[model samples]
Target: MAQTKNLEVWLRGPLPDMPPLLQPIAHALLQAREEVQSFMQDFPEELIWERPAGVASVGYHLQHLAGILDRLFTYARGEALTDEQLASLYAEGKPVEAADQVSALMQQYEQRVDRALEQLRQTDENTLTETRRVGRAQVESTVHGLLFHAAEHTMRHVGQLLVTARILREKTQA
Candidate 1:
């Protein structure tokens, strides 16, 4: 109990000053990537190689996230992708029955995460104020809005990947 209290005190310290809009989005992106990479590291080779039925396997989720980031990047540049393009992006490097693997998926996802983080870091107050007119989305978004949404999207998928990893681990250990 004493140790726990001391640990809590250490953890609950002051943080450095950061712009309000940039701070949360940056932190969230970093956390999401850490979680995804940590979970992926635990996945066994056999499990990563197998295409689980009726659901996205680890590889699928990683590649899907990479594609989403690319689309978000495109959107940030004021271009909109069609539904077919979005679908193709998600399906671009999927397990090809006899040839695909998880290494490629991890590589793609890591690259996307790095690129998105770079973009997030570059956002400024002016950039945040720049408005973007997305196609029929009922809400116009700014660069900051898109950055935050991208972080949220990555977080959502990271949660799923964590669950998938846990399930695989449990199955293997059982």
Candidate 2:
């Protein structure tokens, strides 16, 4: 008797052959968030308003992080967008519009992160391993990769934002 192999595995072949419970991506974000929460608290309102010379201000960087996190969630759902789609939505490479209000942006950022975490928790093992088509950059990515990418991306931006904030502070104090 011929048996049909599971398409789930076939589609998710590029997915890591491991259980997601063991995945550290979520933990990494939690840790990064904890660290950044403290740093974000120290960001000066004055600095948030002033554009850094030849660079984005603290608010712009923070908003950018929020925007990217939202994009990652969009990709994880097997529904990626084209760059054009992003532009139409006003999220195109632009810093978050609510950069001045740190509390608002942080609240929204926390919600988005929580949503991604919840989605990660609900993902079935099979789905996590499947290869999903992303907009133009069709990398053989798994749900796990999408989750990790979100975390890593956040960390990268946090580092950049922190430096910008520090520079802003130094310039002002000088």
lDDT of 1 by residue, 1-174 (tens): 245433322243322444556666656656676667767774676786344455567766777778777777667767788787577675753564434456667777788877876766565667776877665583588776677677788878878777777787788999
lDDT of 1: 0.67
Give the clash count for each candidate.
0, 2
- Any runs in candidate 2 off by more than 4 Å, and if so which? 1-23, 82-100, 136-140
Clashing residue pairs in candidate 1, if any? none
Q: By summed lDDT, which 10 consecutive residues of candidate 1 come out lowest?
A: 6-15
Q: Which parts of model 1 are misplaced by more than 4 Å?
A: 1-20, 49-53, 82-93, 96-100, 135-139
RMSD of 2: 11.3
